[model samples]
Target: MVVLMRRRLVWALAFVLVLSLTGQEDTAKKPARTISIVAERFFFSPSKIKVKEGETVEFVLTSDDTDHGFHVPAAGIDVAIPPSGKGEARVRFTAIKKGNFRFECSRACGAGHNLMRGEIIVR
Candidate 1:
């Protein structure tokens, strides 16, 4: 009886371990949420975005007018966005901290370049 109980306990522990590992794998394999952003002279559409902490996000950037850039210093993201009808740029990052991060244009577009900014709110 003692041997049988020991064997069953070992099997139960192994089962629990497998379940925990599988859960972790599922979390790691989760796909990042994609957010499309439009950049034009002076401002970015949807200037404020909210995301969950620890979530992965992808930003697809496009410009409607002249060339521009997407710069997020806190997240270490900087990408150039081509002009309208040219092409686009993509950046991906994980929101590990819960706070607000600022993003702006790295390239000079016009007099309003400084106003071309946005915020990412991580909750």
Candidate 2:
């Protein structure tokens, strides 16, 4: 009877260990993120963003004036927001590289199009 009880206890501990490891893996698969950003004629709101290495970022981009573009070359994020204060564009990417990557306006809006730039810092 004692041997049977010991076997059951070992199985219970093994099950708990498996559950704990699986829970950790689930958490690792989900990345932490921040809020949204607004792109206008001359600038981007909250022009700088930061995220942890190997984590994902959720970007909600909207334009106030006309159609605009958001491009992050290093992270492979390119999106176009509609014109006339219309719908927004949502882009998601993983920050695997630890550096400062500049995101800019890929479409020409006005004289200040080149000045519309933002940066993402991954730690």
**TM-score leader:** 1
Question: Alpha carbon lDDT of residue 83, candidate 1?
Answer: 75
Model 2 TM-score on a 0 to 1 scale: 0.71
lDDT of 1 at 87: 60
| Candidate 1 TM-score to native | 0.75
> Once superposed on the true structure, which residue ranges of model 1 sit more than 4 Å away at CA?
1-31
Check candidate 2 and list the clashing pairs. Answer: none
Model 2 regions more than 4 Å off = 1-31
Q: What TM-score fits each model?
A: 0.75, 0.71
Cand. 2 Cα-lDDT: 0.74
Lowest-scoring 10 consecutive residues by lDDT in candidate 1?
22-31
The number of the candidate with the highest lDDT is: 1
Distance (Å) between predicted and true CA of 91, model 2? Answer: 0.6
- Candidate 2 lDDT, 66-123, residue by residue in tens: 8788888885556766554455665666777799999999889999999999998889
